[model samples]
Target: MQFRLVKIAETSKKKQTFIFLAAILLALFTTGLFIMFLGHDPVKVYLSLVNGAFGSRYRIEQTLIKAIPLIITSLGIAIAFRMKFWNIGAEGQITMGAFCASYLALNYSYLPRPVLLSLMLLGGFIGGSIWGIIPAFFKAKWGTNETIVTLMMNYVALKWIIYLQYGPWKDPAALGFPKIPNFAENAILPKFLGLHIGWVIALFLVISVHIFMNYSKKGFEIAVIGESVNTARYAGIEIFKTIVLAMFLSGGICGLVGMIQASGVNLTLSKDITGGVGYTAIITAWLGALKPHWIVLVSILFAALVQGSSYIQTAFGISAASAQLLEAIILFFVLGSDFFAKYRLVIDWKGLSRKKENKL
Candidate 1:
């Protein structure tokens, strides 16, 4: 029995190593094909992509700026995903958070700058959590499908943002533009060492989340619930409480992205305030195996892909459409490779069978 257990453990470790290696090779090869398809020398394109992302301080800073929001949103997604919850509505939740933050900032611009900014951040957090909890409530009480509800909520959030920007919040100074007025200067999040405040905060949050997910009793319960809901129930874990709490935390974090973009970068709310960070974050969290630290790495890699492709367009006189196409191609290869990495196919080589089966 001891030997069997040891063999099983060894086999598991071997499979993990093989999958990691395979994913890397597959991503590279598939990206190579994309370069060839674009009629550019794969080597040149690849080098340019590398240089665009990490060849200098300016590039690295930009990459970090992009990574900050991605990491935050992905962290939220990782939580939901680990619990087998499908929250396609992060986009909407983010939008709501931004809208709420913007609202508070605009109204309380008279307050001291630091206090005003604090309120805005709190507004964003509460807004996001509220949006997230809506589905969680229904799911806990009625057993509704969260996936469908979340997806629909995204549309609702989009339209709601549109309604406000166009109808009530429209920047009158912009002459009919569909956006809110710029946030009060005092309400803005301060930049730190030329890096976004969001970056600093996100870094802290990532570490916190890592510790939370891997160490805490609540995290253990979440894991238990994820592995087997029935088993968790039998073990006395409260399913309804876990579901609501997890989803609320997930959505709340996602919403903060909206607040970051609105106050830190855009300084105004728009229909696209979330900048599609919601969807991209899903990819980031999944690619990183739902771990906080790895999610940061994956988010950085994705940032590089976008940053490099944009530069490729600018330098080579390539059209924006083509640059985007190549970016999509590379991402597809990278993401799809992960799927195969975790799974394997066994072939019927030599038509072999076990002795017991052959005898039968």
Candidate 2:
């Protein structure tokens, strides 16, 4: 008896409704306890969070700033998940891409803006693809554990960036800081009005990937493989090829995200350049069920929570660390909702009647 990925079966309407209600009640009750412990009103805190997230144009922009990167990287993550491939190295891949873009921007800042931008993006794609393909290749050729390989590679990337900042890539003007120089005018991406044009690029990529995964024959092959690797083999699908392609594309996309965040926002590279977008994107993928449209909604919602955390710090005399508790709570509920929506937990399996077994 081997464990396997279960394709959660559809349940009756009544059961579906019950699960939905259960998920909501569980989230609310848990959050309520947290509020009580903190000596805060749960309803007031919830309202404050929501208002802080959507209260003004500035807040909206901040939310988009968070959501845009998530949308792009999570889409890449979603692609691999669809093929049942766990690619957890998007963070390293993103860092490598940022490293490449930063290096090029520093060296070739004299080039025309359009050309420099294009090259930065290309550098990002290549850097990320190379990083992504390593683990994928080993997994395909030698049946190596991709999860371990990718996780280890993240530290490698982190150390590489650190070495550069401390040695060759150090900015002369920054006396002691471990950071790169401000990108040249040509090295920077354009801002459309106030919003980074990179957001537009992210939006287009989301739509394009959505269409690619849903309408393309290659997409069907991925879904088949995810459903059953044996079925894919029986259907003559090249499993290794799929793994390599998916991982490459996944890493490449995350790499692009790195470039955009660097050139479009940070405008320089730091050791901790990627922040936590890599991990957060995974949550976005799961919350979205790898669906393109749903991903958008979930990303924005999560982004709102992030923004709201800051608001709580400012308006309610709460520490940022404490505000983060609310975010964790929300994420737990969202993920838990997905679980309940899919699987019915039998807490007391032996107590179930034979009729329930027949129903399941």
Candidate 3:
């Protein structure tokens, strides 16, 4: 007998939902077994994780703080991915954006606080847009591989920021400590009722992206391009223009996250400012299936994992590797379940019959 996999014609929404829930439950169950093997109560560990992430108003705010950058960066990633553009350079764009915003905050301290903040936003956006444009321009003109170019750009941007932090942009008054000068009061993002305004911006962007992708002409063009380049060309969609524009918007949004991270949280620029958000947000974008609102939910779930991981280390006395293990296990199950939902196993009757006849 031979076995093979076949694609399903269609999957019902209910089945997809069930599959998603099953994946989550299976991940939890497997993780629980691992915890049990460690001589710890899995239920207690999970409850502790929930409490640590959302047991209080303060915890919720912290989770939201983490989610804000993920949300913005994921939205940016979703835009490029929607058009079949693999923009893996969000990290570089983020670093460059923060650097631009910090320049204004550090040297242009005389400007009004509100004005400084506005200019910082613009600077960050432009900086990120430029980084995105570099690879995209080459890809459009020369048919170069965007994935490699974008990935290489990430290292370049990262090194540039490190040099600035340790070199020309380093603060001289810190008594030899390698750090940049802090932003002036006006450069910082204001908090509203204990949370930074970045949340507000994130919320607005969520709605805007949904509308743009679902209702706008440009969005439809992007969708077509994603489906097939040949079809897009035949439809006269101006492939070059669409690619460049989409990448610019995508990188620009990622750059805004840099500004938010600097202004709202760190209030300074450093080599570690991005904290791997660019990469993490890509997961959020994919798990959310490139949907703006869906990305919000995925971001919250991921933020919880992050905020809770520290507590797991403290309470369980397990290494940080445990948290990573749990994350990997969960991702594996989720993707595996999705694959089953899209395909089914079938017996190869022709091969099975031949084998039976041979045996006879």
For model 3, state the Cα shift of residue 182 in Å: 0.9
Task: Give per-residue CA lDDT, model 1, range 123-239, as digits (tens).
Answer: 888888888999988987898999999989999999998899889888889877666888878878899999869998798889988887899978778888889889999999998
lDDT by residue (tens digit), candidate 2, 76-147? 889888987788888999999898888799999889899999999999988888899999899888989888
TM-score of each: 0.88, 0.88, 0.95
lDDT of 2 at 197: 91
User: Model 3 residue 98 lDDT?
Assistant: 90
lDDT of each: 0.81, 0.83, 0.89
Clashes of each: 0, 0, 0
Error of 1 at 219 (Å): 1.5
Give candidate 2's error at residue 250 in angstroms.
0.5
- Model 3 scores worst on lDDT over the 10 consecutive residues at 318-327
| Sort by TM-score, top down from the best | 3, 1, 2
User: Least lDDT summed over 10 consecutive residues: which range in candidate 2?
Assistant: 1-10
- Return the top candidate by TM-score: 3
lDDT of 3 by residue, 157-252 (tens): 989988988999888999889898888888999998799999998999999999999999999999999999999999999999988998898999
* lDDT value, candidate 3, whole model: 0.89
- How well does candidate 3 match the true structure, expressed as C-alpha RMSD? 1.8
